[model samples]
Structures are given as C-alpha cells and as structure tokens.
Target: PSLATLNIPTVWFNNPNVSYSKANLGEELLKFEIPRYTEWVRSTEAGSFHCDDTGLICEVKEAVTLTYYFDSWPKLLEEQNTEELHVAGPLLNFKVDAAEAVASICIPHFLCLEGEDSSHVYIAHFVEGEMRLEKPDRVEPHHAVLENPKFSSLGVVFKKWFKQKINTVVLLYHRLHLETPTFHLYLLPNDPSIIKVTRNLHLWYSRLPGSFA
Candidate 1:
C-alpha cells in the first residue's frame, strides 16, 4: 500500500485485537475495514489517535510518574561479601564482582523494562564477552512475544516507575585490598516466595570460601 493511502494508525499494528490474517479473509474486506476505521478516527478526533499523512499516531497519557537516581558506592568495596542493595525503585545494584589477586571493580547500571513488572537484567561476563538481556533459557524472547503476554497491574506500576527513572551507568574500577570477583544482576519477582529464595541464596553464597571481598 502506498504511504498516501495508508490511513491506518501506527498503534493498530500493535493491537492484538486487530487482525492481519489476510489469508483467512478476502482483500475486499480489509480494503473496506481499513478505510472505515481510518475515517471513523478522523471524524471523531479521538484522544488516542492523531491523523497524519502517513497514518495515525497514538498519544497515551500516563497517570502518576515516579523518578529515581543512581550513585556508585565506593565504600561498599570494604564489605566482606557481595550483597544486593536497593539503590532506588528502578535503579538497583545488580551485582559486584571483584578479586583480591588483581583488583576489585564494581559496575552499576539500571535494568531496562520491557513492560510493566517484567524487565531485563544485564549480566556482564568479561571472560565470555557475551553480555545481553536476560531471559528464560528455554524461551526465546522473539518467540515469547508472539504468545499472549500475562499482564499484571503491579507490573504496570513497576514499568511506569522504571520509565520515569534516571538511567545512568557508573563503571567504577577500583583496585581494592579485597577479592577480585565479577558482579551480575538477578531478576526476581516481588513475591514472598522469591524474597525468601533471595535470602537463602545470600546465606548460601556467604558460606562459600572466599566468595566475598
């Protein structure tokens, strides 16, 4: 379709309710429906849709907005073991890796949110040089998106918090008298069980010989 005739809004492309099953339906039906939907929005001047030459643009107004800031903790290097601390709502200490043999360095960053509640944690493994967004090993992110997403109101709230947060990366490489270990981020749900699991993992790591700085 020509750009001039593409009167459809861009938001419609993402809406699951709208069907793009051309094989199931005839072109004539699509030809009729597209223009009809386009005309309806243009005539009504809906709040979500704005008519332009290319197509429609959706302007979704948000409700409450929260913000957060990030600061690197240099004094934390003196601590015996690595522990996750809540820096802010969106910005957090994902991980801190260090070694006593060489130098203990800490990298800080904020995870990117894909949707409400659901966000990605960036794990940095210098030995492998294969750093990317974290996801379930079995589920490919591209394929997972094709399936229906389980939306949560709590997730939406978290998503908004992340969207409004200050995104900054503080890479502080310091040679400490402590251990040289690597740090990484762990994504856990805001559930009671997960909280318990995190505590247990902390205890387990503490028991490991020379696990802490």
Candidate 2:
C-alpha cells in the first residue's frame, strides 16, 4: 500500500549528528508465547510481563500466546479536546486469549519534552469504543508503568494548559512542476495522529495540478 493509504505514521530525523535507526521508526509488532507453567516474562521493548494469581496462565492447562502491536489513534479520540490532550507516543494494542492474565504492562515512549513531569503524562485506554484516560503508576521520560487489569488499545498522552517546547521533527515536501516552485512545510509533534494527518495532506497536495515541476 502507498503511504497515503497506510495507517502508519511518518518519522523523520533532522539532526545532522544523529543517525537514523529503523528499529525506532514505524509501527512494531511482536509476539511471544508463555509456557503453561511460566510465571513471568520480559519483553525488551514492552517491558516486563506478569500474570496474576487468577490469570489465565495460572489456571489454564495450555500455553498462551501474546501479541503486541502499535496502532493508530481512533477517530473518536482525535475529535476530542486535542489541545488539552496530546498523544505523546505510539498507540499500542496487546492481544491475548487470557485478558485476565495480564497483571501489569510498561509501555515505552520516545518523547523528550522540556520541563517533563509525571503529572502531565497518562495512559489513554480505548475501552468499549470510548477513550478512557488513566494515570500510570510510574511516569518517566522513556516509559510509563500501568497496572493492566484488562487488555485494550493503549497509548501515552500528555495533558497541559500551557505551551511547552518538545523535541520534534519537521517534514518538508517540495511541489514540483509548479510555476512558482512551491514548498510545503509542516511542523509536527511526535504524535502518530498528527503525523498521519500531515502525510495525508502532503499526498493530497502532491496530486494537484502543477505540483510537479
């Protein structure tokens, strides 16, 4: 699928001193299998995983498979109070037959904001087609800790009333075959929703007459 059709977000690095890393870019999907008698497991990117006493892993007589993947923000969430609630990281989903087995999940993020604090970051849980914001047990610059009672769509969000500068990337698209030689510039946050919107706009503009020089 083309970039315009895909739901994935675009990532760019503007720093001359920094090299690009593919592992850090794009949506990631990972799967793991827990032995029937296993008690704990660790995922390098998703953090440590554990099952509760009443969890499926404890009661079930067979092994279980866990699937973790990054997802895009739902339209319902994007239409809300975006100024007050900003997505700070990739939206993620954890799928397993044993939703009751999940005890806690630690989601990692790539946001680096100025004057960062735990009060502003939260876990956005998409439950029953509704967006529910929950506070994490621990919030740091790199990740947030959450007690996962149930599995659903989850991501990190930042709430702030005041303006603050954050480390971000800028995407510049040059319009070709134009008489005036136009160039479109977008200053976007690290949020996937915003990136997806910007990429769609870019694709639309690229198809216009005289866009290519």
Candidate 3:
C-alpha cells in the first residue's frame, strides 16, 4: 500500500486513557480502584486524540485526582518507615518533627498523578495560570498522570494563596507512596505543624546504597 500524503503537519490520534497493561505491579494497578466510601475521580489517559484536525475538538475524558490519608503527623508516620518515603508524597527534608512534615507536604503539596486519561494534563493548568502550552508541567504534569504517582497535587488555595508565602512553615508527609488515583484542585494545610518539608529525598537515595543512583 502506498502511503498517501497526510493533511496536517502532524497526525495525532489521541484516545484518552490508552490502556498499556504489561508485566508489572504498576500495570495491574492501572485498573485498580481505591476503596473509599467517598467520591473519587476516574483513572484514564489521553491517547492519539489530537487537535491536529484543525477544528475545535472537544471530548469528555476522566480526570485523575488525589485524596490523602493521615491528615496529621502521628497518623501519617504511623504507617511509614524510612524505605517508604520515596514512594510517598513529594520529597521533603522533615528531620525537624515528624508531625511538621504531615502538615506541609501532605496537607498542602503537589504530587504528580497518573492513569489512562492524562495526555494534556497541562491543558488545564495553562488555562488556569493564564500560561500557554510552554509550561505544562507547572499545572497538569504528565509525570503525575503516568502510573502509580509518587506525589500529590497541590490544592487551589495553596496555588493562589500560600505559594508566594516566604516564611510559610512547611511539613513533610509521605508514607507508602504506593499510588492512588484522585483528581480536582486541592487545598493546603490551614493549620500549622512542627516540621518543614525540604529534601527528605536525599536520605531515601542515600539508603539505596552506592548503586541505585
């Protein structure tokens, strides 16, 4: 078959939540659902669906949001060990007080999300920040919507309010960052804690020995 001339400069076939189940626990978790009695956003992806067609292509797709557990310190650290930090919430250096880490990172932090329907995660952010396509990661990062996300998405209040706060006391909260699918804007901790989430990731890597990095 002879290849015909394509219309647009690029032909993108986007199908949100393009299934890619393969050999691993991550793959299995793609279809896994968190057992919460409350509401939950669906897991999905953005596939070959592209606006390259030249017209306004509007379609409905699932959004990946997150809901955190252990809203407090003792609650969070209760289930965690040193090895579980990397896989938990965003990396932070919370050597101050375990409780401080919980208020800052978990209560008010941004973790990347994943699933099938995360093609243009930036699309949403661009519109919100009044930014353009150049800064996608700032808002809807693909890393978050990939699979078994390790971080959490910061809330709207935190985005607009506390973001510019210079002396805002922060916390660190990441137990077993196994991965859970949740969506929508989030909120930061309204209360103060005793820790600051700086670079807990270093300790995690250091424990990996002299070979992991």
Candidate 4:
C-alpha cells in the first residue's frame, strides 16, 4: 500500500551497521540468546537479570556496533542523517546523556553478523509481534523541507500503544542509542497495552555449539 494510508507513525530506526548485512528472523532471535551463559559486560546491578534482561542487552549491543565493526560508518551516517532524513517523522530525538552509542549498536549487530559473510544492509527486523503497536488512522505525508534536505520527502502517522489490563510498562531496554549510529524506539504514547503483549512474548535463543547437522 502507498505509505499515505496507514494510520500509524512511521518510526524510522536507522542502523548504519557498515557490514551491509540484513538479519534473518532466526538470527535476530539468537542475539537475544547469547548473554545468558556469560558476563559480557559489567551489569548495572549485581544481581540476576529479569527474565528478559539478557535479551534486552543483546539488542542494546546490536544498536551500538556500526562504529566499531564497520569502522565508524554510523558516525558518518548520523552526520549525513543530520541532513538526509530529518524530514522523517519522529526522528531520532536521542537525549543528550543518551544519544546512540557504540555499545547499544553491538547487541543487535552481533545477532545479525557474527561469522556470517557480512555483506548486506543490516536492516533491523521490526518485531511485528513484539512491538505491541498499531496504526489506527490513515497515513499522511510529513513535511520536512524546512528541517533539512535529508528529510524532504518523508512522513508518517502517529497513534498510541493501547495499554489496558496492563499495570506496568517494564520494557527490557529503555534506551538503545549508538553514536557510531542512532538506534531508535518510538511509540504512539497511547497504546501501552500492545507494549505489555510484546513484553510478555519476547524470547532469546541458545545455539548449541556445533555445526548444524
């Protein structure tokens, strides 16, 4: 369908993972699977992680790696994005203390790369099931001409993540920022209900150490 009829915001998450690798759905799930068996980094609290903490951190690292593995491609893209896709709705409005960083990009990147050939656009898979969001209105073209040349022909719709029968919004990864890149997470603000559904469904995978039979 033309992007002009969806009643949901087009949350754009750019992953400049210089490797040019797009992750397969199975591979994406693997990144969430890795951390359970080891201590990759120092944890914020010295206690056991919540059920999905390991998965959350994996996504965090994937969000931070383009700078390192791709040799600072995300840095360059962020600089370009400052000009190229600014007209896009809900651009990466990262916080000063928390703009996208290398660490955040690594989690998701690793899930997609590892020892693979690593030569394709590393597109982040929008977990349609896990995102717990929906579009309730028709799509509309966004105007970004005054913002920047990078955003001239872009637009999106905004709605909410309906939060009902849901009492808490315990998203595993609150922030996924990467300076080497910009990892984004957007919501309709009204659909918190979908958030809980995805939260309840998130999972990680563990690869048995061996070549597949």
Candidate 5:
C-alpha cells in the first residue's frame, strides 16, 4: 500500500494560525506563521511542534514563516537509482528564511522490517541533481535525526537484501456475474508508483461487465 492509501493524518502545530494545503501529486504543505523568533525557539525547545502522527520534528535557527512540503515515496525520484533501493520515509522539502534547521522523522516500523539492521538505513539528500546518502545523526527505535545545513529533498532509503521479508498487505476483490464469479488477488509492495498503477488498473477493471455489485 502507498502512503496515500494509508491516509496518514496530517501534522498539527501548536500555533493555531498554521495553515495546510495539499498538492495534486499528494504533497502535504504546512505553513507556520511566527510572530516572534524568540518565542518560536522557546516553543521548539519545549517540543511543542513535534508531530506524533508523522513523527516530524523541525527546529529552525531564526523566526520565519516556514513552508514545508512532504511527499511520500515520490515518483520524481524513481530514476535516481538503477539498483533496487527501498524508501523508508517521505521526501521532506522546506523553505525558510533562516540559515539552518534540523529536521527529523520517524521511519515507519513496517518499513524497518523485523530483524533488519538499523545501521543499514541512510538518509538520501537530493541536491543539485545529485543524491547523497548520509548516516543519520541519531537513530532511535522509530526515528532518524538529521542535521540539515541546507534542505531540499531528503528521505530515508536502504538497500534491500536477498530474502529480506517485508511486511506487506494483500488485497482481494470478487466480481459477480450471471455466468460465474471471479476473484482477483493482488500482492503489492508499499510503493507509491506500484500502488498508483494498481489503483488505475482496478478502476478500469471495475468498468467492465460483471463488475462488483
């Protein structure tokens, strides 16, 4: 299943003025309006902006209207690597007037399959048409911390090992007709591209005769 399919809840900020919007490509945008830099910093110190749903923590150096965008396993990065690489988190993009900020996000437990080594996970930073893999500053049971000097597109990725058992979901549907009933079963990865394609195909199939009643 894709992140979009999961319908993950959006992050909520302590500041009620924070606004949110969603892009057609399934990107989540969050805008923070801060009146005072000092107060904002104090709130961050108090962990008022940490989002439990998405496990996102952002700390800025200066007070600024921050605009953040998150896309789960974006397709834009599909061609980044010819080799197989599994994504563990969403792509984080942000715009701020500040010079630097630290961002951290929790890798979904399902993506970090049981028995998989945490040390093998890395943060993939996309800059200047290049992707750089870096080790996280801190790794917790469910979170990976990164000190980002410059932020563009950052996500967690890992090389899939042979026989690595990934936790997955299976979908089943039945088509009923006068002649006979047919069942369709699908085994899918937790990838956005595959999910999107599968959804489109399912929609097409639903339009045919003897579809789900």
Candidate 6:
C-alpha cells in the first residue's frame, strides 16, 4: 500500500528524502505462545477507564515492579586489545520519580591509553515520556539542510532518514513486574483511549526477571 492511500502525513510520502520498499516487509507473522504470566501497566489516574469484559478488575494491591531485558546485543563488539578488560553495564534501570519518569543507560567509552574508564551514564528524563536533553543541542552537520528539532535523541535523529520506510519510536524503560518489564512509549495525538489501549496491550516477557532480577 502507498503512503498516500494509507492517509499517512504528506511529509512522509512526498519528501525527496523519503522512500519505501516491501523487500524488508515480511509475508509471515511471527507467532508467540501464551505467556505463563501476563503483567500489564495502566494508569486510571491518566484517565484509563476500567471495563468488566474479563469479569475481573485488577487493582494495585501494593506497588509492583517489573523489569524488561532486551536480548543480547545483535552482535558482539570487537575484542579490545588492552591489557585489562573494562566492564560496563548495558542494563537499563527505569523508575518514576514522583510524577516524572527517568532512565539511565551505561555507555562504555575508552579513555586514552589508560584502559577502560568508568562507563558514562547517558540520562534521559521525561515529564511524560517525551525525552529531555540538556541545552545547546544541535543537529548533525550532515543533516543541516533538513528541518529538525533542537534537542532530539539519537532515535529522533535517525527518523528523518528512515521514517518513511518504518515506524521508529523511542520507548524508555519504565519498570518490571511479575517477571516482565514495562516501557513508556511517547504517543502523538496523545489520545486517552489509544494511550490506554497501548498500555493495556503492551507485552511483557514472562520468563524475564522482575526489577533488579
């Protein structure tokens, strides 16, 4: 299907930088077995209406935490030729502070010939899942000709080049509960109903460990 027929925004279809192809699209859908435990995240405070369709209304008895773990890096990094191997954490920890949400990811970087230094902490804060970056942000020099935001994440930067072909939204880690981790994906249009449905249907892997697991 063409973007025009799908009612996709004009910018995605008409822009010279955009292109589409079905080569990357799959004909077969991957299937999953029913999970042993299903844990979901929903906020009635955010106006999520409760329905009795399931004949059970689950409420937060006490604060439950869930942790989501992404599979191992798609590929391993090149071996470091240093005398000592430096270790860094790629594990992401997400927590909500009061009403604000915060995420921290440990990124490994080399420091001169001194071997590996402490991993740098790349922090992204969100008032409501929209990423917050420090001031003095600039677009990459290669893309200066195109329009973009002043403060955008790496995910946002890549979108301009590939958005027409795919839907890429950055979701920050929220927490884990019942052997599953929750994530917060910023929604556009921010419709209350859509937001609730997204939250309700968001999947969690049952085999994964809980928060800090």
Clashes of 4: 43
Write the number of the candidate with greater lDDT, choosing between 4 and 6.
6
Model 3: lDDT equals: 0.22
Tens digit of per-residue lDDT, candidate 6, span 16-126: 112211111024222223222222334433222222221111222233332221111111212323122221112112232222211111121111212222122122322
lDDT tens digits, residue span 139-179, model 1? 12111111111111000111122222222222222222346
Better of 2 and 4 by TM-score: 2
Per-candidate Cα lDDT values, in order, are 0.22, 0.51, 0.22, 0.21, 0.48, 0.22
Cα lDDT of model 4 overall? Answer: 0.21
Clashes of 5: 0
Cα-based TM-score, every candidate: 0.18, 0.51, 0.17, 0.17, 0.50, 0.18
Model 1 misplaced stretches (Cα beyond 4 Å): 1-178
Candidate 2's C-alpha runs over 4 A off are 1-74, 77-87, 98-111, 147-149, 204-208
- Winning candidate number (lDDT): 2
Model 6 accuracy (lDDT, Cα): 0.22
For candidate 2, lDDT tens digit of each residue in 59-171?
22234456654454644475555557766666655566665444566665445643555687888888876888889887655567776446777888877666544545577
Predicted candidate 4 versus true structure: per-residue lDDT over 115-186, tens digit per residue: 332222122112211211222121111111111111011122122122111111223322223334322232
Candidate 6 lDDT at 131 equals 43
Regarding lDDT, does 1 or 3 come out ahead? 1
Q: What TM-score does candidate 4 get on C-alpha atoms?
A: 0.17
Best by TM-score: 2
* lDDT-better candidate, 2 vs 3: 2
**lDDT string, candidate 5, 50-127, tens digits:** 544334565544343445544434344655772756665545554555534434333332353444476777778777
Q: Could you tell me the lDDT of residue 122 within candidate 1?
A: 26
